[model samples]
Target chain A: MLLCGLTLLHALVSGSVPIPFATVLQLLGGQAADPAAGQLQTIILQLRLPRALAAMVTGGLLAMAGAYMQVLLRNPLADPYVLGVSGGAAIGALLALMLGLGSSLVSGGALFGALASMLLVFGLSHRHNNWYSEQLLLTGIVVATGWGALISFILAISPDQQLRGMLFWLMGDMSHSDTPTLEAMLLLVCVIISLPLATRLNLYAQGPMRAASLGVAVQPLQWTIFVIASIMTATAVQLAGAIGFIGLVIPHIMRRVVGADHRILIPASALGGAILLLLADTLARTVFTPMQLPTGVLTAMLGVPLFLYLLNKGRRT
Target chain B: MTVLSCQQLQLNVPGKTLVSGLDWDIEAGQFWLVIGRNGSGKTTLLQTLAGLRPAAGGEISLHSQPLQQYRRRQIAQRMAILFQHQESGFPITVQESALAGRHPHRGLWDWSDQDQHETVFSALQTMDLASVMQLPVDQLSGGERRRLELATLLIQDPELYLLDEPTNHLDLHHQISTLEHFSGLAAAPQHCVVMASHELNLGLRYCSHVLLLYGNGAWEAGRIDEVIDPERLERLYQHPMTVQPGSHGNIYLPA
Candidate 1:
């Protein structure tokens, strides 16, 4: 992890305006950047630093949320996308853009949409006495279809010039990040607020009946964890325009590597998710050199191969 | 004093009624062995009492509080259940799974050390299961999981213990050991243990009282001598079952 961080620092320092290690060190140590350090400090400290941090945090949050989703739904194949969280978030961000909200409403809007989807799914899935997994699956399909219709409606009525920006946003980008929301995302500290501590979440994974018998407040506890997961997933979607599989791919990879103790897996996954996304973003940004590709497309490109390999390995295990 | 009282309790499913319009009261510290054949209402009665399923009509009261008034967690703290059947394989360590019984006793913020650890530890040690503490639950041989679950139940430490076919999968040695262990639970004045089983001879030997569930929802709850009848069994279950004397002066079946 330290090596990865150091490598990233080195990469950031070597951007269009190159900064010396000594100047990077001085700036990190709380001293002002030397005039001799010039535009390099400006690029590294202001632009590259926030971008890198944002990628890492977003990736980490998505992965943890995805891991929680698979466990909560009790389906090995379940991911955030299957529950309509991703689709709702995408539709919300799309709508916000069409309204000329200009990115400020993106994260919270996505989070609100995710929560609405969750409530809808929960209400629909509840049966006479207990919840059935089949009902939940159907609800997800309904909500995702509804969100798709809304997105299409907004696009069909949008102006031609605005249409290009809307399409680009939907394709996903990290460039929408500003100084404030990124700072707010940092304050969210998903690990502290999420899963509502490791022990309860760990007990919950054993299935609802056992958990309830053991005295877990199953209904309230589940809702709390779900809300935290929704917030984290929404924040990630807003920052990176609904990037795919950071949640799904990273947790699966970590589960194969680390054991399933959520106490250990949660922290390990957060770090793993952050590091993997940072490297993926770095590769996306640098691979085409001067030409840029959307970080979301690159993530999917990287995720699919890794995901398939993990799937094959999972079958063997 | 009656610790559990039922007033006009009726358990009914969609098509037919299992047990209906029955009124009974069981005093504190009185153990019951409710015996019935397959398709009889023994399992249904127990599930209804445990609040897992709703009673079609009638009311049950525990310690003067209506059963419906107790939330799931409150009920969990007061009663524990051991299933007659369990899933064979689960991917977790015995210790990790056993600790789950402490689920109701803990607050969200912190896990109390003295209570949680002491409760789980004593439960494990009491069942002679400390040796297999770290073993994977799935890796344990067949009868071992039942013992582990027993430890979990003990950790729950509810005043009322409910068992459904508790001895179903055990070998002869384990069956006797389990029955004997249950017979020697906490001697508090209000503690009660209730189970349903086909092991009539064992039920006769250990249980303080018996509840016989028969055809057409015909029922009797009283002393074993009053309820166990050869002719009644022959007519109801349609099997020529017999009971004989055993070495401990308790009843046992030779055939």
Candidate 2:
């Protein structure tokens, strides 16, 4: 939490136009009054503050969704996008961009696409009143592949004028996010709701039969995790446009630090994810100065090496 | 008192009928060993009895109530099952794994209290795993994993235990001591055990009753002595059986 606060303050103070730490604090404290400080206030409050919160919320959401997905599929390699949710969202957002839809409508389209993909995977994998994890993984991967094909097809036919905007969204840009409040509320609600199921989730990670034997309603719990994770991934994609590595890597990192107890792992993953993304976004915007890099690129570049190192270290130990 | 009862129970795998028209009553203070050749539906019957799988035909009742009518948690609180195969997908401490046994008794948002911790600790000690409670389950040996499974089952402390190949992967000492522990548990009032096993000698020594599956929908259930003999054992295995008289009892061996 201290790290989160420090990261947030750093993000607020450092930007293309560096605002002094005192003025940033003054603006945050609701005391910026001078004409010069007004512009600084706008820069801090309107631009950097919302972006920081969005990064935090988006990061936290993706990480929690990843944690749930890993358990729900019983695969350590499972991530939020493994189910093709982002592919679906990408298709929807790209289509909205192609048709010149408003930004809000693009988000709505992305959400609709995500839901469609979720239902597709759910329907395909559910049979004989059983939702087998292997079946779900296979079906999700196939559907994601199909969505990927569609995404490429859409990109090939899109107009050149809107191509840059579409590409930025695809690479996960945060500059367009105007509403972090909804995403923040979602992150809060997900953490609140998921904590109660932490113990059950621990049993669930063992296997479905054992989990059932241990008193978990395995079927219902599986469905609940799937739905909650899909919504989280959808909202994160809607807010930040397919930021990738936070969801996949943050949970594993947190698991190493806090062990596999969901009671601790879940909250720790959320906080860790928030901090990592906040730092990543700060670097994404300020490192390049006037020319902003896509936040997802920075996450992947940083996350890949860290993940590989962890994997190698794990094998050694 | 009957702890679990099944009427005309049937179990089947895709192309084979394993057991059919089986009526069995597991009374309190009885240790019943399910004996059969491979694919004879011992595990299937145990799973069906535990309500882990649906019976092809018949009714399973726990304490005079229909098993289907009970909620999963309620059923879990009354009955526990240990599978032959155990795998941990994630790294977890032995203590955490054993603590999962308390899940059935705990409510949502209820934390494990001191009593549960003590219970888990004792179960770990009984399984000879107290020293390695902090070790990740994946790092444990096959025998240690089996013991961990037993410890978890011990912590569950249900009225009925349905264990499929409970002694698999266990060392000789652990196998004997674990069976002895289950025998003791079954000796207590309001507790019963049904375990599927391949060890006929151990079954004879520890089990009060025997359930023989013939792998073709035929079965015999009665007191161990009444249902087990050289001739029946030979027929059960479809091979010649030699019985060596030991000080404790007859040890049956394939000939």
Candidate 3:
């Protein structure tokens, strides 16, 4: 959390209207900067501040969600978007874009579609409390493909004007969010996913038979966990477009330290996720001086090498 | 004292009839061993009796109430089962696996309370898994995992125990202890323990009722000596056989 906070602060101060770290700190402390540098300080304090904060929340939410997914499924490859929600959300946003719904409406459309796909999966997965975790897993892939096709169709027909913003947002950017939106997204993430995921998710890692024989209503619990996970993924995808790998990689590392015990692993994973994405976002902005890079690209660039190393280590083990 | 009665039970899986009309009264304080050749429905019958798989042909009643009316959890509170072998999703601690038995007692997403934890601890101790409670299930040797499974069932505190091959891979000491444990349950006049066993000698030595399934699906269920008669035993295994009786009504299975 501290790392994330620091990175956000730095992102604010390092923008075009460069505010010195001291002035940024002073301005954040509720005092005005020197009269000559007021425009520079205000630009950093007002404009870039919300954008940076949005990046932190978006990155944190994605990474935390990814960690939860990997641990819950016991599938190292799992991410927040492993199910169809991301693709479904994308399709909704794509439709909004083609229809000229604007960015504001597109966000809501994506979230709504993501949740709807999740509900469809949940409804289909439950045979009245009979667990179809495997079934749900397979269905997620199929539905994601179904939505991806629709999204592609919309994108092909879309004009260049709408396509430009859509493409940039899809790659994940912080500039899209202002202060109020970022705060609302943060509140939503906290309130919706605040419960102990580690404790509840242990059921899946324990296997269906063992969980059921031990008295867990496997189907209902399995659907509920994944639904919650998908919702978080959908929220993040809606808030900042699709950011990858933080969800896939972070929880796996947390598992190495915590030994797959959800009670200790879940919260630790959330902190790790928040910090890692915050660092990635900061690097994205800093790596290119004038040409701004999407944080998603930076994350992928960083993740590929790290994931390769972990994969080799995992194979050896 | 508690009794488990299965009346005209039929367990069917789609096109196949695993168990066709299994009827028996598993009275309280009796140790029953179900013996069958592979694919002869030993595990299926056990699963049905334990209410893990719903029977298609008949209804099961617990303590005179129809079993279907009661939820799986309500039934689990009164009966516990130990499957032959159950592997978890990954490496789970022996204590965590054992405490899973307290699932029926759990209200919603919560760990075992103080009283429940103590009971589980005692169960672990009884199964000689106290020292390795924190060890992951995948780390334990096969025999140790088997004992850990027994401890899981022990925590249920049920009136009856339904087990499928309770002693699959155990050292002589643990095996004898397991048999002795059931023997004691048989004599206690309160608990009813039913298990599937391939050990004929152990079955004759400990169990009060024996249900035998022949290679071609023929079955004979009754007293030990009655089912263990040389003539019937030879026909079932399709070989020459002899049963040498011990002083205390024990039947020995000699090679």
Candidate 4:
């Protein structure tokens, strides 16, 4: 969390028009003494601060969701998008863009799409007196595949003028980072609600039947995890346009450090994911000087090798 | 008092019946061994009794209440089931896994209390897992994993235990000790044990009652002395068998 705070501060000051550390601190403390530094103050407080905070929260949300899904499904490859919420969101966002809608409308459509997907998975997986975990898993995978096809179809038919922006969103750009309040609230709420279920989630990692035998109320618990993870993923996708790698890799990395106790691993994953994405976003902003790469690209570039290194190191020991 | 009772319980697959019209009563302090050939629905019968599977046709009552009336957690507090094997791709320490058994007694989100910790500790010690409490369960051998699974059952401390193949992958000594421990648990007036095992002699030695499942949906449940014999054993397995009166119990062997 300390590193996350520091990274947020560094991101706030290291933008195109760099603000000195002292001025940044003064502005943060509600005292911008010099009238000459008005632009710097505006940039730091209004623009950079919200964007940086949004990046951190989005990263934390995605990682936490991924951790829950991995345990809930008992699959290491499970991620925030495993249930097709992201694919649904992407389809909605892309549809909005093809119709030349505003960014807010696009995000709203994305959230709507995600909700539809969640309901679809939930409804199809539930049958008369039988809520098998495998049924849910298979349903989610098929729904995600369906949404992926729709997203591709949208991309192919979109007009040239809107294609660049759509592609940036697809690759996960934070340049148009939405307001952070809703995302921040969701991040806090998800963490608070999931903290209690963390221990139960640990049992679930063994298998659903094992968890059921251990008194976990496995069906209800699995449903709760699916909803929480879906909400987190939807909120993050709406804010930052489907960032990757943090969700898939951060929980695995944190498991090695925190030893797979969901209580510690979930929170640690939140913080670690926040730091990682904050650093990646900052690097994305500054690496090419005047131009910027999509933050998702940088996350994968940085994450894949680091994750592989950790896995290899674990195997050696 | 009768702890578990099923009337006309029938277990079946899609096109065939495994066991039918089976009526049985399990009282407190009774240990029952359910024996059958492979594919004869021993696991299915145990699962149905544990409320893990639906019975084809019958009413199963726990503590005289309809089984479906109790919530999953309520049922868990009353009974624990040990599967033949547990597989996890994730890593969890032995102690942590054993402590998961306290879930029925602890509130949701609450950590294990001191009494719960002591229970898990003793369970670990009983299974000889005390020396490797901190080791990841994935690192344990097959026998060790089986013992650890038994430790989890011990930690659950439920009124009834439904164990299927409890002694699978265990060494001879561990198997004997584990069954003896189960019999000791079943000696209490308010507790009972129902195990499905292929080891006819061991079941004969430890269990007071037997439920032999013949392949053609036929079954007999009674005191071990009355229910198990050379004739029934041979009929159940569809093979010739020899029975000997051993010092401990009847020895069943294929002739």
Candidate 4: tens digits of C-alpha lDDT, residues B171-201:
9999999999999999988999999998888
**DockQ ranking, best first:** 2, 4, 3, 1
Worst 10 residues of 2 chain A by lDDT: A174-183
lDDT of 1 by residue, B1-255 (tens): 676678888877678777877787767676789877787888888777777777888899988889889878788888887876663321568887888787666666654445576677778887667889888787776677878888888888787888888877667887888777777763457677888888877777778888877735677888776766677666656677666657754454423
Ranking by TM-score: 2, 4, 1, 3
In order of the candidates, what TM-score does chain B achieve? 0.90, 0.98, 0.88, 0.96
Task: Report residue B35 deviation for candidate 1 (angstroms).
Answer: 2.4
User: What are the DockQ scores of the candidates, in order?
Assistant: 0.37, 0.84, 0.40, 0.69
Candidate 3 — which residues are off by over 4 angstroms? A1-14, A17-26, A33-49, A60-74, A116-139, A142-163, A179-200, A304-317, B69-74, B103-134, B213-228, B231-240, B246-255
Model 2 per-residue lDDT tens digits across residues A11-100:
998888998888788788998678888888888888888899999999999999999999988887778788888888899999999999
Candidate 3 structure quality by residue, lDDT tens digits, B1-255: 437676777766566665655677777888888876666678877777776676778767788777767766777788887887674575668887777677677665574356577888898898898998877687899999899888878877677888888878988889889888867866786788888887766677778888876534346778775666767666655667655658756464634
A212-268, model 4: which lDDT tens digit per residue? 887777778877887888888888888889787788899999998888888889989
Best by TM-score: 2
Worst ten in a row by lDDT for model 4 chain A: A128-137
- Stretches of candidate 2 exceeding 4 Å from the true structure: B113-115
Chain A alone, TM-score per model: 0.84, 0.97, 0.85, 0.94
Which candidate wins on DockQ? 2
Clashing pairs in 3: A66-A247, A131-A219
Instruction: Report clashes for each candidate as comma-separated counts.
Output: 2, 0, 2, 0
- Cα deviation of A264 in candidate 2 (Å)? 1.3
Q: Candidate 4: what lDDT?
A: 0.86
